[model samples]
Target: MMEELEKLMEEAASLAGIYSQEWTNRNPSDPGMTILENLSALHLVQRESAAQVTEHARISLLKLAGFVPLEPENARLAVELAQKGPFSFPRHQKFYVNNVCFETEEEVRAMQGRLLGVYVKGQDEFREIKELKEGVPMNARPFGSEPLTGDEVYFLFDELPCGRKVGVQLYAEVKTSGTRNPFSEEEPVDFARMRWSCLTSCGYEDIVCQDETHGFLQSGKIILWIDTDRLVKEQVGARKGYMLCCRIVETAYDRAPELVAVHGPLFSLIQRDTQSFSMSFGGREDIRIQPVFPEENFFFVYVREQGCGDYIRYAEHAGPGSEEVQGRYYEKRLMEDGRLQICFLDRQRRYLPAEEENAVIVICCNREMMLHREMGVLGGWENQKFDLPPGGCADAKVLCIGVRYAKAEGSTCCTFFRPGTEKRDGVFYTYEEDSGQICIHDAGPYTGCNIFLSDYALSVWDAGNIRFGNVLTSAGGNAGVRVRNPVRGRKGRAKESFQDIRKRFLQDMMQPVLAVTEKDYKELALQTPGLCIRKVSAYFEEKRNQICVAVMAGTEAAFPRLPLLYRRQIERYLDKRKILTAKVSIKDPTYIRVDVYVTVSVIDREKWDIKKVRQEIAEELDDRRNEREIGQIISFDSLSGRIRACPGTGHILELKTIPAGVPGRFIRPGTDIPIPPDAACYPGDIVIREE
Candidate 1:
């Protein structure tokens, strides 16, 4: 700036008083030299202005004494909830705070999980449903008056599996009247609530386990939601003249609410009937706050009670985020969503007396109100001020949670005032978008207190009482309950994430051999993309002169039932690679968990960490991940090696195992103990001691 000013002054030497002699003179002592003095004064002002300008460009750089520049962001998700009959919500739901989504991908059946429902009933609500069990009926009575001899019943199951739903065909003989016979072979008994209709039609009924009950309906088709990962095979008899094909519908059309946050407690809200809304303050930028980048900043959101200013902050439950890798398995990631969140509990079997009307959701975040910027000034309205809109409680019914800004009085888009547009929008709703901040939606109503909210409703209740489905009648009269094959259904495999896909592809390329022997078969299967079940094994049956292969299908979370399709794919691969004329059979392998018991003598117990020893044993024994393969042998050598590999193992004393479902003696050390041909060895109960 000084050099430019000097050059300008030199140029002004050619012009006289028009430019002023102060700028032309280099000496400050000269009487007419005010230009240089004024230039130096202006430099300080410009320098300060430039520094402020730089600070405004970066949000991370800007700071105020009591105000934080960035507001914390909330994690949002789209969630789906279901209900059945009228039931009150739990006083409190048991939730895993750090992570909110269900971890185990294992399928949950009617007998596995119970849903709570609510419906209006003349100023009163009733909890009528006690349990809803899955699976087919096992017993039934002959529906007729009969005198007959030599009657036999046979049950047959399909060898192939359906996706989830199965069409069941029932075949039974019903006579209107009957003559007498000895009721000894088939006893004659009766119950008070004799509703044969439950068995006659499964269409209107929520089929237990989404099974053959649909065939019982006899009318239009009904769909059942399969919560399992996959289905094996199920076949039922043709009962009641209607040949039922118990088939499953793999998909469904459903809508979900935007997930605002994942926190839990006994807070209540006037929920929207079909939809829920989220209020985010940080993800969107504010025009009033200047110097924002074209991009938005990220924040870690935290919560506290509305009235308790200095109370302990609580963390919300979060489904896995997409932003960064987490945990020992760094493959999972989370996206950064800025919003206020409020989660609630769904059901309580214990029955709470608290009324819904008085229940309120009070939430607060460590809000960083932004109102500063550098490049351009917001609210350039001269002599005029704009206020923000009212947020939170809407009509005293809606539970409002989030920050609300004031409405603007004058023109927000232009520098000059525009007439009569009126402040039609809330402060948070309107924005000078050309500025970094983008206006989203109107501020949510104040729920008595401003806050963000949870986007889901969790159905939590007691687990033990739910044992069976609709039928509560006692067994055996003169009737025999015809049963369908107990073939379970699943939720099916989820589409792999990019990280998982990449890891799997890369891992698949790491395998270097073909499948001929058992070891080779196991390795090839484990390395194959999309099919890494717990273990894989190959065995030859000389009688059939063919190779029989099986796989422990599914991921590490829980053992998965291999669908017929996947099993077929495996067979195709193995068939293609097997020696000519050697037919191969690839099937789903059963699992026999091996319980390991050990009491090893260590020179010093302190030297050997018990936890590490157990972990090592698990790593080597557990067939799911590192050590055990699908059909690999249960090697004592590997077990001892794992124990010796522990940091503190000085020596060993004893180790034995009790095979699952089998009651025998322990397998002594040094035994080969190959896993059953159709079975995989899973790590069961472990009792470790230092002798």
Candidate 2:
């Protein structure tokens, strides 16, 4: 601004010389020069004000370029209910930590039954299995080493929830080979392959309700809506109680499921609140309702005319014709103070009865809601501006700003264009998210025209990431029930800020929407929404015009394979982005199993714990397994150095890789293993010995 002011003074002096040279008393004490300086100072202040762009304006500019700020996400947590007997927990039951509220997503019935014994049928005999407790996970394969048709696993519970829905939680041992891809949309269970039944007085009866375990290919909860009124007491492996049996109707499993433990009555929790109210409006006027607790997370607002039996649709802009007002829709926007206001169509497009009509408003609280209000009447002037949050509405993020006005034909039109852009049959304006100001331009013909804030949304930012153990009390009136979150809340996010969105705008624009090259295919596969992908490799088969994309999951398990369901999702995601001539094939990379053996000499036998050293070496090898990529070369020459770096190791006496050099084999001990172009190496086994 100072630079511009100085430039202006120089230009003024040059102009004064062109007119006359007698008034060239350029001293600072001259009256004319003093007035010029004052005007320049005022000009500098105006320029400074113009240069400061507000947050709403920045976000609006980004939107003009097709970039939108993300909305706030609610956090989620898994809660445990500690109670006795069969207590039913209804969905949306509120739990809280002072002011922060968490609600249940599903109904869970607490079971009073205790798992007294576990049994597996073998050669026509029921054997007692004591491997259901902690520290005995790997040894407990509930369906035996090789599960076959007709094999049964029995769970004896001492008590039962009579005639109610019971929740059964299954914890699978981590040593299993299969992985659960959280992003996979394969939710339908293969009910034909498995059968879950309970022993009743009339014999076995089907009791399966909902099975989230996917036939035990992963760890999940199973819900059983059972009738325990006629449940029979069955004797299984020295225990006489009600038996819940899981039998294999058909042998179909990636790996026989191993059970670490089985418990019941698990529930899911989310950070949100829900409320509804009634409001009335008449004569086609604007309506404003201030919430009592404004700081709570507000997600959605639904308005319905009383006795209409349907919700009035929320539209972003007014329709081009007056008939659209009869579509039963309402617009929401933000006032100057940032509070949400609901607005209706103008008298030209819509008319209400003289008597007030009732409208029901349902509020879904996750910290965001629609807001609309009349900005003010516009005058035929240059740079007409209206401030949004003149006093209140602090820390509120405004999502979008739309305007509507009446045309010369007495019909209404709406637009989202900035000033000087081709008018889309409506008014033009710019908004600032930071200052909550809306500036109108090019309003010469529309003097006295009413400017309505047609659309906008507000959200609270980043205050929902509560810590574990923070939720301690139940807000709902369920006595004898205590809730605790075992894991910290996650996925809660604040709305994206103006500066943050700007930094990624160029990079996002540069990303290719169509998969035309190998790099494009790899990037698209890695960006498949909801999937945790560790690595991706794209290979183009020129002859067939097929791009084969191999994906690796972001998991630390012993073995990770791309499930058929996940592969289908990836294929569909890429299919929408590929060219007409290109064919996409989603596949899993081949794996090379490498076993390691080492013998080490310790400096002090008393100080060295060989078991701990071996465990550390195993962990290092696991890290290597996770970091390997397709066609990567594996070398054993660095094995000795890595083992020696472990504490309690003095020297490596012998080191060898499996299949490299056996008793009569010609292979060398520390040979570099060359992998195939489509294969990745994974750790198979590690055997450590002390010399």
Alpha-carbon runs more than 4 Å astray in model 1: 1-535, 573-581, 605-608, 645-649, 660-666, 670-672
Tens digit of per-residue lDDT, candidate 1, span 1-691: 6676666555544564565645555455765556645665576568768777443344233222222222111121111112221112211111121222111111112221121211111223222111111222222222112212222111222211123443222222111111111112122111111111111223322233321111121111123333122432221222112111222232110110111111100111111110121122221122011111112321222222223221122233345542342221111123232222233221321211123221222221111212211112133222322222222111111222233222243211111111222334321322221231223333223112222222112111111112211121111111111111111111222223334444555565565446667566655554443333455677787899877767665432355566554565566655556567667777776767877888877766567788888888777766655645565667788788888877767666777866675535435566756556676656788888886
TM-score of 2: 0.50
Question: How does residue 179 of candidate 2 score in lDDT?
Answer: 30
Model 1's TM-score against the true structure: 0.26
Best by lDDT: 2
lDDT agreement with native, every candidate: 0.34, 0.59
Q: Candidate 1 — worst ten consecutive residues by lDDT sum?
A: 251-260
Model 2 lowest lDDT segment of ten = 391-400
lDDT of 1 at 309: 21
